[model samples]
Target: MTALPQERRVVTAIPGPKSQELQARRTAAVASGVGSVLPVFTTRAGGGIIEDVDGNRLIDFGSGIAVTSVGSSAEAVVRRASAQLQDFTHTCFMVTPYEGYVEVCELLAELTPGDHAKKSALFNSGAEAVENAVKIARAYTKRQAVVVFDHGYHGRTNLTMGMTAKNMPYKNGFGPFAPEIYRVPVAYGYRWPTGPDNAGAEASAQAIDMINKQVGAENVAAIIIEPVLGEGGFIEPAKGFLPAIAQFAKDNGIVFVADEIQSGFCRTGQWFASEDEGIVPDLITTAKGIAGGLPLAAVTGRAEIMDAPHSGGLGGTYGGNPVACAAALGAIETMKELDLNAKAKRIEEVMKARLSSMQEKFDIIGDIRGRGAMIAIELVQSGTKDPNPAATAALAKACHAEGVLVLTCGTYGNVLRFLPPLVIGEDLLTEGLDILEQAFAGV
Candidate 1:
């Protein structure tokens, strides 16, 4: 295996000749719907660096949107997946189940935040896992209505589209979406109508009231939420909000599903972000970092609730492909051996400290929120909470030009999110932040 130099190096233009040609080819061959944050094309990536075809080694602050928390090509992940590939590729778990799939399920049951008898069903993406969680909840509760939050992002599937709050890119023209999905206000502290202090109590109370009066708690099958909301900005619900919602769901017999796809797998210092609030969800959807970049997702929850569906109800052919399972096992091993949870906490400390300092200098940085390595800076008009999407776009472009891979998100399209690999060196991280400060100044 070739070890890529972790240091960032820009030998040519950001999208040099080689990447430019590839981008042209991609435009012709690939669909326009598949959006990319950066125009440069990577030939190799490892240890916090994405080596593009132009020989530009860019610092990876994105980590493929938190899919490669152990770095793009971790040793254990590569070794196990390679061994599994040589042994066998696909033997659909349904037709001929394998030990790797079962092992992953066992790990999920053990690692996810729960002390109950847990069970898991694998899938190929976060969206699919979420879809299946809804199925399980509906089957178990015998209800049709599902409650979601205002700024929560579930997935891109038909059902998830209906659950998602944003309409521009995710839901627009993709409708009409699946019925029986309801969206309610989230305890978004920064823009909370009353104030951050009251956000938790007021928002959760209002959300519960909506579920009771409008959807009717008895009619609700599930109340799914990202413990820390992704896509709709990395908005962590106000403190006390999660417990309140979880309690409300429990009081009403509604299956509480924690969509921890992005915030799970040590990205947020804990095994799952739900643990932060000591909230034990009835069902948790996981993906992204689960397989160290391989496409794998799962719905892990109470065994009784999970078994609600029939034998033939919840699985896909590629749900637990043996190779992907091997990768997952390796990824989990890496997380344990390296103590990535602690590393994630260290990252939170370092990043939040640096970003908090930056917020002092840049008024556009309206809010610096998020936990652990999964952090974000909400950009806004100077001295006001008004979103500054134009400034966000320009700043991202600036970072791109300087060979730093940063990403942007938010309902108003004005958040710069950071999800660097947990294994990244402090040197690279500090350098990336330096570039960020420079980019902000230029903006």
Candidate 2:
């Protein structure tokens, strides 16, 4: 794969003159609702750096919100996608069946958590996959209610907005969400009422009790969760938590859906985070890293559950676009060839060590958690557990100013998440962490 310079070179102020000029035009043309973290327009990006309009090369830690796990311009992804584009960009899979779509489904069936008879349907985005998973679950179970967890983030769609727990940016002023959705407590070990050791059992018991007393499991179609919560902070649910919930879903006939959008591909050490707890979900929603940079998502699950929907029940106009599917195949190939799973694990080892040391010095860092490359630090008050969103914001701003891309997310916005590309070299990773350390020091 062709590589970008594995260096952090800031030739100008963060949003340099050229970027500032573009920003002014963007301000007038783009809708106010659309938000951007770093406003400098990216002219080229690959490996671990993104070169902006003004030639500033920034270290990439966000990986385009975990969409570039195989790297932004993976050779396989680019080659296959480009070849497909040359042949035919879009015939619309719905209109004309394509080998690429079928091939991607075959791969997903083999890759997702379960070994049982499986099937898949592709979509344009993670939100679309999630929505379809819900639809399939309800259809299969002949039930209406869907259950999610606190500190969960599904999507911006009306249905997923109701599934998402946060309110401000995602759900503010946008109401009348889909009904029959219930929220339960997640096993957030760091913030759990009980101690971390007891968090799994406590949270599972509470969620089961709530489902029975309030939502009635018999009436529920699915229980969706992120194995390692994303955007809601990279909160890896306590060890036994996921298995307990999966068993509960099995016993109650609730379609257990793992929303692996942010945690899937090789972003986590495992191909799918659900595998970490050995909890084979009945349905798994995936996207982000699935197709390199191209938009693609899938709902892979038990064949019986997937076939529950009518023939015309699931599909989108542009679902599994040929080029995107080709990109997905190539990305998967690249992942296997390069063993990105091991790469993610190594990243975790490197980051955990560095971040743990940082945590020792910075008491504001309340917790460090996550698996593989999808790691994060929860910022809090110096001596208290109270979230310090201000500190988090300042730290991220500092990173941006110094030519590094870091993302902040959480219900309280007190999280700084690091999702570097799995292909990022150790040197770049170390450099980015150095920039993070400097940002923390300044903040």
Candidate 3:
């Protein structure tokens, strides 16, 4: 087997000559509304190193926001996808079905958390998957109200915008959001109203009580949540939170939807984050790393619930494009063949050790949390848990200047999440952590 790249070899300052030229071109050609990190333009990426247009090599830690878990250009993914492209690209599964699409659905039904004879529908983005999941739930339960948690991020679509909690980029100026979308407190341990110990289950129960009293469980269609909150900070719900909510949904006849878009495909040390809690959701939305960087998303749920929407209810023109299906199959194969779940666990072990050490040394690191490779360090003011967004931003910039790409997320933008590809090597991983430590020290 070919080994992954190691070490950061900075040939020129980041955004080197070629990158500078490309950046100028990008400014003119691309939309200013789009945002990017690490101005360096990538020419090639394999395993952990992203070779930029200037031929400068940098260690990757973001994994394209956890979308390339098997690596940016895994041999398996490339080979399979290329062959499929040669054959054909799109023949929308809705208009003209294809075997590849059915194969992907079969794989999803078998691998998704539940084993209740599930069915699946595909979409092009996470937001679409979430929207369709909600539609399916409402159709199945015959209810209008859908509940979402604070600090949860669903997507950028109209309905998902209301489901999403963040306001700045995702929801700002994009109102009036869809109605019947309710927001409740999440089981955020660090900023919990109650302490972290038993607060998770308590918060969940309390939220359910509010829904019952306010929205009325009978009128609620689904409770959509990220098993591990993604853009709202990589906050993993308290131990009992997911199970408690799922049980409440089951008892109240409300659908339970797990949004695993950012935490699926072995990113959280499991095939799906919901698997960690051992709770089976009625519907699950997935994207991000599902197709190894291809734009593919899916909603998998109990057969009856998925079939609730009338014959022509759930579909899109580009939904389940053959090329994306092929890529997804390849991505799944790569994950299984390389044992990426175990690789994620291994990355977690390294992260816990390094971040724990950093925590002892740097008061700025308020909390370190996440499962497997989906880890994060929340920055805070010295001697207090107050979010320190400025410090986080400075640290990220410092890392980027040093040819180590990192990403910042959290409601306050005070959290640095490390979502390196599972295939990253120990040497590069340690080097990236070293740069982070230096950045913290410099700050």
Give the local distance difference test score of model 2.
Answer: 0.93
Model 1 C-alpha lDDT per residue in residues 189-295, reported as the tens digit of each score: 99999999999999999998888889889999999999999999999999999999999999889999999999999999999999998999999999999999999
TM-score per candidate, in order? Answer: 0.99, 0.99, 0.98
lDDT of 1 at 140: 99
Candidate number of the best lDDT: 1
- What does candidate 1 score in Cα RMSD to the true structure? 0.9
Clashes of each: 0, 0, 0
Residue-wise C-alpha lDDT for candidate 3, range 168-248, written one tens digit per residue: 999899899999999887789988766788778888888988998889989999999999999999998888999999999
**Model 1 lDDT-worst window of ten:** 1-10
Clashes of 3: 0
- For model 1 the local lDDT of residue 331 reads 95
- What ordering of candidates by lDDT runs from best to worst? 1, 2, 3
Deviating ranges (above 4 Å) for candidate 1 = none
The parts of candidate 3 lying over 4 Å away from their true place are 1-5
